[model samples]
Target: MSRYLLVVPPLAGHVNPSLGLGQALVRAGHEVAWCGPELHLRPLLGAGATVFPTGSRLFRPQSDHGLAAVRSVWDRFIVPYARFSLPAVDKAIAEFRPDALVVDQHCPAGAIAAHRLGLPWATLACSTMDLGDPLAVLPRVHEWVLGRVRHIWDKAGMPADEYFDLRFSPHLVLATTSRELVGRDFPEHFRLVGPLLAERPDQPGFPAGWLRPDRRRVLVSTGTLADDVSARFLRAAVAALAPLGDRLQAVFVAPPAELPDLPEHLLAQARVPMLDLLPHLDLVVSHGGLNTVCESLAHGVPLVVAPIRHDQPINANQVEHAGAGLRIGFARAGAADIRAAVTTVLGDPGFRVAAARVAESFARAGGTGAAVAALARLTESPVTTGPSRSTS
Candidate 1:
């Protein structure tokens, strides 16, 4: 059996997909080792892969300050990613001498190490990368903006153009989304492998009165990490749906301490897995996070997306244009807009049908299994030469 080294970012969304891929690799009789923060140990070990913890300050964000949070991700998150991960991954390669390296697309250090060491490597992109094409689900402008930011970051120290040139140029880019989402013709090296989600085990039972027919079950969430905007969106959704009275029941996934008073019929705060709660949901109100959007689609539930930062606006637009959901502009959407969007989706079955179709397409793309197979193939046919480097 060949050995494989998987390098993942510390965030739950990034680590979660890598965990699924690691589990599938272990099941296929490959020895896998994961490097990240200590918190990831339990989950990685549980997947039957060996774990190595690295120092990553990005794992902890100071949520009290919004701009600080964003800055911290760029500086603390991306900087250390290059500094610590390069040496750690190189050491792992020298010691364990893995047949190949499987890394998250964001971790360019791993790609660099794989290149320098002359080991085969593949990038598992969790989000859309094609930014130029109008038909692409992820807008080109967002990519341009992010690229400029990265360039500024590089000029400060690393030279962003060279980084993208060396790290992203010729690596086999394995995306978790299908071609339907990106209209551009992908290079031969880039392959669409569908969504790489962790398989759900049977979850704990829902609380009593969690689902009430008297009110529409609206799930309000912004995922785990970036939850500040979630509160604002939730407040709007509650205000919009409150008029429905017993017709709308809003379930917000958040710590109870952070929740404010809302309509008694609305479930303001609760701790629940999104996958578990989505199946019973009538409408999902969210910040257009990838996991949340994908999970909603998986359950055939329509969305009312109020996006704030990052890829959220792109995801929201995808859902809206596809007829599976509606996008309420982050700066503009108020309670009335949130309510109207939710009502429009709930009132029409066509939205749910479109969501179901995308979910079906996702299933046919082979989910995590295809990712596992791709990794396995690397073990069988290792790419000895380093990927071509380009300046762009």
Candidate 2:
């Protein structure tokens, strides 16, 4: 039996996939643990899980949309957080002394620690931000991102001559998506293991009575991280879906206080068991989060996506390219625009067919099992796959 450590961020979308992979590792008779903020990790992961707490700090929320959001992710969160968390991650490495690590792409400190100790590690790519080279179109933006990564590496005293991209591990990169949706070829090291659909904690109870047999069901969620920026979108979604309540029931994942005067057919909640709810949904109106989008497609449910920022636009484009859904402008889309997009998706049978096709591919891609197999391979060969500075 091998001991493996999972390094993840506090975000639900990032951590959820790791939880599933960790469970699969445990089921295979291997020991598993986590390194991240304990306050968030303890609740997301149950009490049974072993977590090395790195504490927490208040970084500014990613409230900006479009290009600004990308800048905030690197300047405000990724770079600073890596610096703040590096010491703790280094300490965890010393204490855990695991055979290998599965590090989230957003948490570069984990990769740095792995490189520092010459540990075998695999990159867990929960989003498409790094895979397709989205920034390649803008040479300056792409260079800026690389500059930030290099700055972090230099600060950590890593070898300047051997600079490997922190977003990818030389050993392996487990992407939580499929080729059908990616609409592009993957690198040799990338393994498209599809969505890691596993049991999650703090699953809010859903009122089964809310569903009506006569009406088709729809779920409207703009994702968890962008509550600040999503209020306007959620309000528009409520308006768009309100008129269609007689034909369909809509569930909005938002606080009741944010949206007022909801019609009888609409329900608003802060959180819901997305995994459990997806199977029952006929259509999903989302912010194009990779987890929600992949899960919806896995259930053969069509979508109307409004991309706000970061990898969301890329995911939205993929959905459109795959003929699985339509993308609307997040900031410019009003009630009518949202309604029109929703109507188009619901009216066209082709969307459902495309969604089902993606779902079939996801099933064959081997979700958690494939990821485990890849990690297992890395453990068997513990040689340093990436260049690292040696103390000796």
Best by lDDT: 2
TM-score of each model, paired residue for residue: 0.82, 0.97
How well is each residue in 1-392 modelled by candidate 1, as lDDT tens digits?
A: 77888877776666666766776777778888887665644543454457666654544553433233335555556555666667777777787788888877667677777765667888877654323233234356445436644653454354333355432426466776666544346777776776676654433456765577666688887666445555666566667877777577777776665666766766655556666677788888887766677768767788888776555667788888778899887656888887778888989999989888777877877777877777777667747464434222
Question: lDDT value for candidate 1?
Answer: 0.67
Q: 246, model 1: CA deviation in Å? A: 2.7
Candidate 2 per-residue C-alpha lDDT over 17-102 given as tens digits, one digit per residue, 9 for 90 to 100: 88999999999999999999989888889888999988988888788888888889999988888888899888888898899989
Residue 303 lDDT in candidate 2: 91
RMSD to native, candidate 1: 4.8
Query: Model 2: C-alpha RMSD to truth?
Result: 1.5
